[model samples]
Target: MLTMKNVTKVFRTEMVETHALRELTLEVKSGEFVAVTGPSGSGKTTFLNIAGLLDDFTGGEYRLDGVEVRQLGDRARSKLRNEKIGFVFQSFNLIPDLNLFDNVDVPLRYRGFTRGERRQRIERALERVGLASRIRHFPAELSGGQQQRVAIARAIAGDPKLLLADEPTGNLDSQMAREVMQLLEELNAGGTVVVIVTHDPEIAARAQRNVHIVDGVASHLDRGPALVSPALRTA
Candidate 1:
């Protein structure tokens, strides 16, 4: 569960003050797959940063899993983020020199998991993305879709409750994009709270709920039951 109540973010310099977000309020329930769409410069990036705990809002309240975040210190914030939120980005962000296994192993190491535990998590995450066979392959050797899968595996390696994806399919071709979306849908079906930030309508349309942002304000454009997963429909 992620909730933002009347949130505001302002960027200030000696010359001017710019408001990236203005009283933006949104809520994502657990077991929900949500898509956030907006035009360029519509505060999408700002919202993603704030939502993923990568940046702080100038005003208003943010609660993740019912814990307020505005008052948490840097270390506490990092801890909470690592334990609760997993991030996937447009660029994939894989280290070119590291193999798939090591790439996914990076964040788990930060969690201070024992060597055997990290190995277990890395293998399990890679297996989940269907990349366990390529664990020893470098990012440069794989196709774009495969690299993105590696990124997804790394994000899920921590077993996070919330998965935040920023333009996850932006760099892939249509076929690859569809594959990635299918994988995301499967993950969502398994009850991970999936929040995707994308400019593609086809991608956004797949989500059960859509939130459109303009000039820092958000509006809900809820989809129909066709988009809802079987588990959700039954629930």
Candidate 2:
């Protein structure tokens, strides 16, 4: 569903040129749960930003769901990103003042959905994250994991075709991390293409495939069949 060929990102100044990504090539298919693991300065964030259409690459080609992103204008890119990609950040980027329902409703509002539709999407998104009853609760009132769930809810409310998560469980305890991972797994099973960028080995191990980046390029990729939890195979 996502393809990148010879992707290069360069940051140039009068004094120096920094190459954040160098000919990075990778593909993520529909319904795949892929973990991107890399050390600092390895260009993981750069790749994620480009993949999500948040930033443009200096060179190379990127096709998202068959559309070549390089040819699109900013407005078109923004529209496609809002329509096709969902993001979960390491820091739950929830609005501090908005309650859970409103936080989830913010993006839907931008989509120009009717009030009823926005409300329905918010509730259903929260329900999927197991936070329906806490719709009125504020972010400060919830645990770290709960807050992350709210972030995930906000992301998935649009029913995006691709889900991009960066350090999704970085702030939670082990149990909460497991819970959040399980939720992501469930979503992937339901057919959303999931690409997670993380540093935690345990977290990387849970994904169906692993893509390791180094020196701004994909250095390793697991070529085996999907590696889902055995319990999920029967479910």
Candidate 3:
């Protein structure tokens, strides 16, 4: 559903040029769950930002669900991003004063859904994440895992075609991480394409495929066993 061909990202300063991605070519098919693993400063974040349309690439091409994003205007890109992509970040990114219901409702509102429709979506997304009972809870009232679930709920509330998660379990304990991963797996089983950027090997290994990045390039790609993946294992 997503394709990047010869994509290169360069950050330029007056004195230095930093290449975040070098001729990166990759494809994520519909319904696939793929993991991206790399060390700090390995361009995983840059790739995610580009994939999410949060930033632009300096060279090459990107096709998201068949539309070429390389030339899309900012307005068009923003609309497409809202309609086609969902993001789950390690920081949760929830508003402290917003309850779970409203947290999930925020993005839907941006999409101009009616109150009834937004409510339905918010409810369903929360239910899917096993947080239906906490819809009234605020961010400060929930644990780290629960807050992250709310973030996930907010992401999927729009029925996005692609889910991009960056270090989704980085802040959670083992039990919470497992719960979140299981939720992602369940979502993938139902046909939403999921791509995760993580440093945790065990989490990356659970995915159907793994992509490893080093020095601004994808150096390894693998499918199958967890032990064979390049990222460092945690327990």
Q: Please give the clash total of every predicted structure, in order.
A: 0, 0, 0
Ranking by TM-score: 3, 1, 2
Q: Please list the residue runs of candidate 3 whose C-alpha ends up more than 4 Å from where it truly belongs after superposition.
A: 224-235
Candidate 1 C-alpha lDDT tens digits along 57-176? 999999999999999999999999988888889999999999999999988988889999999999999999899999999999999999999999999999899999999999998777
Kindly report which residue pairs in candidate 2 clash with one another: none
* Candidate 3 RMSD to the real structure: 2.7
Q: Candidate 2, after superposition: displacement of residue 172 in Å?
A: 1.3
lDDT of each: 0.90, 0.90, 0.90
lDDT of 2 by residue, 115-174 (tens): 999999999999999999999999999999999999999999999999999999988887
lDDT of 2: 0.90
lDDT at position 50, candidate 2: 98
Question: Could you report the Cα RMSD, in angstroms, for every candidate shown?
Answer: 3.7, 2.8, 2.7
Per-residue lDDT tens digits for candidate 3, residues 108-226, read: 98888999999999999999888999889899999999999999999899999999999999999877887788888888998999999998778888888898998889965675573
